[model samples]
Target: MKKNNNKLLGVVATVVMAIVSLIALFPIISIVLSSFIPSGSLMRNGISFSFPWDELTLSNYTYIFTQSAEYWTWYGNSLWISALMIVLSLFFSSMVGYALAMYDFKGSNIFFVAVVFILMVPFEILMLPLFRLMMDMMLIDTYLGVILPGIVAPVAVFFFRQYALGLPKELMDAARIDGSTEYGIFFKIMLPLMGPSLAAMAILQGLGSWNNFLWPLLVLRSNDMFTLPLGLATLLTPYGNNYDVLIAGSVMTIIPIVILFIFFQRYFISGLTVGGVKG
Candidate 1:
């Protein structure tokens, strides 16, 4: 009787989870189906899951590929910025985090506290001063302007620092005894161990950089310099709304992030778990 009850509970739990999964996936499914229909139909209906299958068309994709030149440019700009942010942020933030975690330096605790304090402060509070600094440095309207401020993210630093604390220090001692330079010890012996943290941050920072609009809007002057999110916003104006390009382009924007998450998903969960546990 107990065995039968246990089996029944398991079946019920599976059914409940399946229903929850479908509920979560509803919005994504709706957007994908909406992308197939005409933009006019979409604008009129406001994204319906019950639309007739025959009403679907491929013209939205065709327009984005053929007619939308600016769309490609925006896509490229976003891709470049996101890639640079992930690489540079990981390289510098990891080094700082590892040093804070492993080495007993003067003001190390002070630096960590500062990082936590800065993390608590909102980005909006810093934007005005950062904007002025960018202007003073003559980096406005450039990719450097967009990428510089975010290169050493506080959250990434904190995450890395926390994760690095869990790394075995005996490896560092052994590497030192083997006559490895400090950089060699970190790059060769330590970095490989932080793979999960790196993958996790790459996905997170990539997503943030790709979707960022306000900062880019403040710094970038020319339409050519605009990132994907900024470019997509311009499609809706007082004169007209390019719902066709908007919806299609929006769907395309999800592709890179989805790919990033899929590739790094194995590490992402483990990274977050371990990183959080130490601190």
Candidate 2:
């Protein structure tokens, strides 16, 4: 009787989760379907299944490929900026996290506490000060301006620190006994074992940077330097709302993130699991 009840419970849970997943996916589906509707039709129908399918056209996509030079420019900018931000953030955040977890320094504990505290504070409060600093550094309207602030994310540090705590110290000791330098101990001995955490951070940070709007909006004055999110928002100018372009553009933008998740799907789960486990 217990076995049968357990099987029944499992089936009920699976069906419930499937329903939730469909609900979560409904927005993306709506956006995609809307992208096919003729320009101004979505504004009129407000996204109903009752709209005639035969009237849908591919001109939205056609505009993107052939007539959307600005969109492609924003796409390329996001690609490179996100790619660089991931590299720098992973390197610096992981390095700080590894040090905090492994080494006992005078201020190490204090530093970790500071990181936690900073993580608790919201970014909105820091924007003015950060912008002032950016001005002092003369980084405005540049890729560096968009990316510099995220290079050492506190959340990434905390995640890496927690994950690194779970690594075996014996490997570090063995590397040290082999006359390996500290850099060698970490790079050669530790980095390879950090596959899951690295993959998770890359995906999370890449998505955040890709979807980010406000900071990039503040920093990028030049249209050519604008990231995808900002560029998408630009479509809704006071002069006229470009809903047709926005919907189709948004549908296209999801492709890269989907590809990233597909490529790192295996590591992403394990990474989050391991990184969240206690010291």
Candidate 3:
């Protein structure tokens, strides 16, 4: 009887998860289906999933491939910026987290409180000051202007600090006893243990950087410097819009983030669970 009940529960859980998965996938499936449809149909009836199988064509993708070199350039810029932001953010944020979690120094807690406070404040609030600072530094219209602000994100730091709290400090102490320097102990012992957190942050930050529109919009003045989202947005006008290119280009944008999630998915959940604060 117990075995039968357990089996029933397992089957029920599977069904529920299947339903959830389909619900999540519905939009993506819609986008892909719509990407193949003609732009005229889209303009007539904007963004619906009533699939017109007979009217579907590959011209959207073909245009992207054959006619849009600028689209590819925007894509490349987004890719590199996201990559650089993720790499720099992970390294610096983890280091900050480690210091906060493992070290004891005057004003450390105060500084952490400041970090949390900054995290609570919105980036929209910071944008004006940041933009002015960028101008002063002469980093405007440069990739450095875009990349510098995201490299040490407060949310990433907070996440790493919370995740680091769960790590065993004995390893650090032992490494220290064996003549490992502070840098060596962190790089060798703590970093590997924090793999899940790093992977999770990498996915989150990478996705954020890739999809970022507002900040990039503020910094980037030229069409040549546009990221994917900004570039895609430019397709619209008071006149007829480039629905085909927009749809196809938007579909292409999802590929990198999907790949990042696939690679780091194992660590994503565990890291989130560890990093969550309890009341």
Candidate 4:
């Protein structure tokens, strides 16, 4: 009787989860379907599960691909900025985190505490001071201005530090005894061990940088310099809304993030779970 009950419960749980997954995916499915819809229909109806199958057309995708010069430029800016941010952030943040976890140095605790504190503080509070600093340094309206402020993000540093704590310190000693330099040990020995953490952080950092809007909007003056989020917003005016291009472009924007996750998904779960275990 107990065995039969357990099996029944498992079946019920599976059905519940399947329904939940479908519910979560409804919006994504609606958007993809709506991309094939005509601009006039989209403006009139907004997005919905119901589609006029006969009216669905590929013109939206065509318009975005061929005529949207500004769209491509925004896409390119976001791509490079996101890519640079991921590489630079992982490089610097991991090192800082590793040092804090491995070495017993002066003021290390204070630094870690500061990182945690900063992580708790909202970005809005820091934006004013950061803006003033960027202006003084003449980095405003530049890629550097956007990328520099967040290159060593507090959350990344904290995550890496927590993950690094669980790494074996015996390897560091072994590398040092073998006459390896500090940089050599980190690059050759420690970094390889951090693959999962790196992959997880890459996905997270990429998503954050790609979707970022406010800071880019505040700094970037030129239409060409605008990122995808900023550029997409400009499509809506008091006179008109470019729903067709907007929906199609939004679909295209999901592609890179999807690809990033697909490639790293094998590590994503383990990385996030392991980092949290130590903290």
Report the Cα lDDT for residue 202, model 4: 83
- What ranking emerges by lDDT with the best candidate at the front? 1, 3, 2, 4
lDDT of each: 0.86, 0.84, 0.85, 0.84
RMSD of each: 2.4, 2.6, 3.1, 2.2
**Candidate 1: tens digits of C-alpha lDDT, residues 53-74:** 8898999999989999988999
Model 3 vs truth, CA RMSD = 3.1
Better of 2 and 4 by TM-score: 4
Clash pairs, model 2 backbone? none
Task: In model 1, state the lDDT of residue 59.
Answer: 93
- In TM-score terms, candidate 3 sits at 0.86
Which portions of model 3 show Cα errors greater than 4 Å? 1-24, 259-263, 270-275
Candidate 1: clashing pairs of residues: none
- Tens digit of per-residue lDDT, candidate 2, span 1-279: 999999999999999999999989888888888899776777777777576688779988888888889898999999889889999999998999899899999989888788778877888998999998999999999889889888878878888888899999999998888999999989988988987789888877877788889899888998888998999898876443577678899998997667766887876565445445554
Show model 4 residue runs off by greater than 4 Å.
237-240, 270-279
Global CA lDDT computed for model 1: 0.86
Residue 252 Cα positional deviation in candidate 1, in Å, after optimal superposition: 1.2
Error at 256, model 3, angstroms: 3.7
Candidate 4 or 3, higher lDDT: 3
How far out, in Å, is residue 255 in model 4?
Answer: 2.8
- The digit string of per-residue lDDT tens for model 3 on 1-279 reads 999999999999999999999999988978878889888787788667566889889999998899989999999999899889989989998999989999999999899788768777888889999999999999999999999888877777878888889999899889989999999999988999998788888877877788899999999999999999899889875444677788888888886567756787776565445445443
On lDDT, the candidate that comes out on top is 1
